[model samples]
Target: MSQRILHHPVLGSLEERHSVQFEFNGSVYTAYEGETIAGALLAAGVRTLRVHEETGSPRGIYCNIGHCYECRVHVDGVPTVRACMTLVQEGMRVTAGSVLPTPLKKGGHAN
Candidate 1:
């Protein structure tokens, strides 16, 4: 299989010195240190970042930088982390969902 990838904007002119291996959705991924998880996932063609709380809607990384809060994931047991802001470390564990407990809104008391 031939895979083509676009480099992240931050890696201007300098080659990635260290390549790290990690997993996403049980699948293996290789990315450079200092790169955001979302950017790495995008380079690997990971289009869906999350599912809606109740609708099961699919999501993907957008706005390579962390501004949209679209590529949120559970990183190393931490939830609600922005994939675009979190750098990928070797052997890091990540899950596809919000780590933060869902707030109860039955009476509009919590969010």
Candidate 2:
């Protein structure tokens, strides 16, 4: 899938915007000033932000809004933050699924 900037027929040309640098899973990436974390990642061709706790299924942004938690990621040591709702800032550190705690077993011990 091509993630390049699109020239909308109605919107004509997209205005030139300032670019900021951020780290995704330890790799640096460039994103626009007002773009959300999910937007930036998608633009960079990143489809999965995390994995399912139980089945380890790759999960990406399912809802642009804050409703779904599929885009949950760790930002600056914080966990379970929704990527679709969080805006990307310069020098921000985003970890894909690493900060999520290990799943607990039936006896409450981490698996």
| Best-matching candidate per TM-score | 2
**lDDT at 71, model 1:** 83
Please provide, for model 2 over 1-111, each residue's C-alpha lDDT reduced to its tens digit, 9 standing for 90 to 100. Answer: 438676988878778889999999889999888999999999999999998876688999897798988999999999888999998999999997743455575568643
Estimated TM-score for each candidate? 0.74, 0.84
Candidate 2 wrong stretches, greater than 4 Å: 98-111
Please give the lDDT score for candidate 2. 0.87
Best by lDDT: 2
After superposing candidate 1 on the true structure, give the runs of residues whose Cα lies further than 4 Å from its correct spot. Answer: 1-16, 98-111
Clashes of each: 2, 0
Error of 2 at 9 (Å): 0.8
| Local lDDT at 17 for model 1 | 64
Model 1, range 1-111, lDDT digits (tens) per residue?
Answer: 213344657765556468898888888898888877887887787888887665577877868677888788888888889998999999988779733345765457733
